[model samples]
Target: MKAWQITTPESGLRLAELPDPELRGGGATLDVLAVQIPAYTADLVAGGRGGFPLPIVLGAAGIGRVTATADDVFGVRQGDIAVATGLFRSGRAAEPEEALLGWTGIGGDGRPTPTTDRMRDVWRDGLCAERALQPERTLLALPGAETYKATEQLAFLPWLGIAGAGIERAEVRAGQTVAIVGATGQLGSAAVLVALARGAAAVVAIGRNRDALDALAGLDPRVIPVALTGDRGVDGPAILAAAGPVDAVIDTLGAAPTPEPTMSAYQAIRTDGRWVLVGGVRQDLPIPYGDFMHRRLTLRGSWMCSDSTILDLWSMVRTGVLDLSLLDIQIVGLDDPAAALTAASHRHGLEIVVLMP
Candidate 1:
């Protein structure tokens, strides 16, 4: 089988003919159809994300058809279309932190311990290949995916799952106005759709791109687009003006160098409203402790979605509430993943890149 392998930090990715993965106990082998190239794939390849080991296949989310499965893998069978839902390791009484599939190959909280090192053998390789072997816990079967040509929809599962988890954490309710920071990006756009599908009275799409904001607003009349001014004082007021006193805010700003944009979103939140952080903003936010205390604001951080969240999202997609047809998907081949990675980095608006392996 051919796979894209990252041999070293800051080194170029190379296509290598690797041996087929062996399906072990409780694991299944998938004939990968399509895998989403996240914006951060380049960062991971360049060793900016974390201490991911070398010689690893670099993808976290994909949709595939099961070609084979172990006798113990009972959830799915051969010929089933399944999506990778991140890696999950069974918890022990002593240590119970679950590690994800892509970067965190070793499944634990942080730092590679002996337990994680041993578990690395199970999850080291990701989905960027002709075939992938994944544990049963990480694969979710999509029953009529082939009939609907849902491979494009699979590209969105990771982002949608993250956004859904954040929205769920914010406890957004029906008839309440919700604001999605960085709404022009893929994650933010997904959040807007999810919020609307969940019956939010209105969605405020806040971002730095005017054209993208306009495009999002055109999706639904209830979507109110607001462009960020970059000035903290002005942006906060702009967001509030467009959304009209939002009840909850889901911040999806990724790797924001400064805290101003996020702080502005925080300021725009209504009193007692929840602010959920799911993005990759790196700076430390200097929140006014007293103001936060008096306003009764709820601040929460959500990392990823659970099985239930994925099930709910799938149901919404199946029912037509979450319309994925509006998304612009770009499919590429595994031979030139570098070009796809570059394209993913420069991607804006509703455009998303997927690798057809």
Candidate 2:
């Protein structure tokens, strides 16, 4: 097996011939089909994300074909097509620690501890190579995924599941309006589609990229793109005018320099509307206490999706409720991790890079 190995944060990714992963208790070995290379993978590999276990395979959530499962592993059987969610939870009753195998997502708190490190040490091999060993707990079997011709596009399903979960947390329903912050990004784009599939009357897609925003608006008549101009007054009024008063606002902004854009969207929501934070924004949100108390608003934080959500997303894809064809996927090979990482960066909504091993 040829797998991309990272010995140290600064060492970068190197392709090395390694032994194929063997099934272990509570785990399953998979013949990896496709892995979506995230836009920040280059920065992650360059030590910009965070530290992780060394001498490990570096990849995250993707699709795979089950080759074998350990005796303790049930539900996911051999010859089944499943999505390796890359998310592993401790299932601990208190402060349950979690980690993204082969990637840098630490615990639910995004802070590392001994428990998270141990979790990564055991399941360090991700779905980046031709073969991978994954925890059965993280594998969700996709019944009819075997017939899905667009494997590369299907690799993006995990993200859709995540975004769909955000929408679900916001309690979005048919005939309601949604405001997706950072709508030009990959997850935001998925939220737009999910919002539509969930029967949202309109999706006010808000982002900084005009071209990408325009592209989203072009997808469906229900999509209304709003390009941010950094001014909260201007952007907030624009968002409010777009839909009058949005029923839910899904904040998917990543590492924003300022929280104004998010706040702008937040203010545009209706009095009793919901706000769900599903992004990596690293700022302290300043919520007006009096206004928040009076408005009876609901604010929630959602990170990853549950198995049920992933199954629901698969059903959406299978039933044509959500069109995976809308995504413009760029396929890359396994040998060149450097090139793939480079290509993965700088791509916006519907424009993605997938590694087909």
lDDT of 1: 0.82
Model 1 per-residue lDDT tens digits across residues 194-268: 998999999999899888898898988999988888898898888888867789999898777898888888877
* True-vs-predicted CA distance for residue 124, candidate 2, Å: 1.2
Off by over 4 Å in 2: none
Candidate that scores best on lDDT: 2
Best-fitting candidate, scored by TM-score: 2
Model 2 Cα lDDT, one tens digit per residue, 100-201? 888888756788889988989888888788899999878999989989999888899899988999999999999999999999999999999999998999
TM-score of candidate 2 on Cα atoms, chains taken together: 0.98
Error of 2 at 344 (Å): 0.9
**RMSD (CA, Å), each prediction:** 1.9, 1.1
Error of 2 at 219 (Å): 1.0
TM-score of each: 0.94, 0.98
Error of 1 at 14 (Å): 1.6
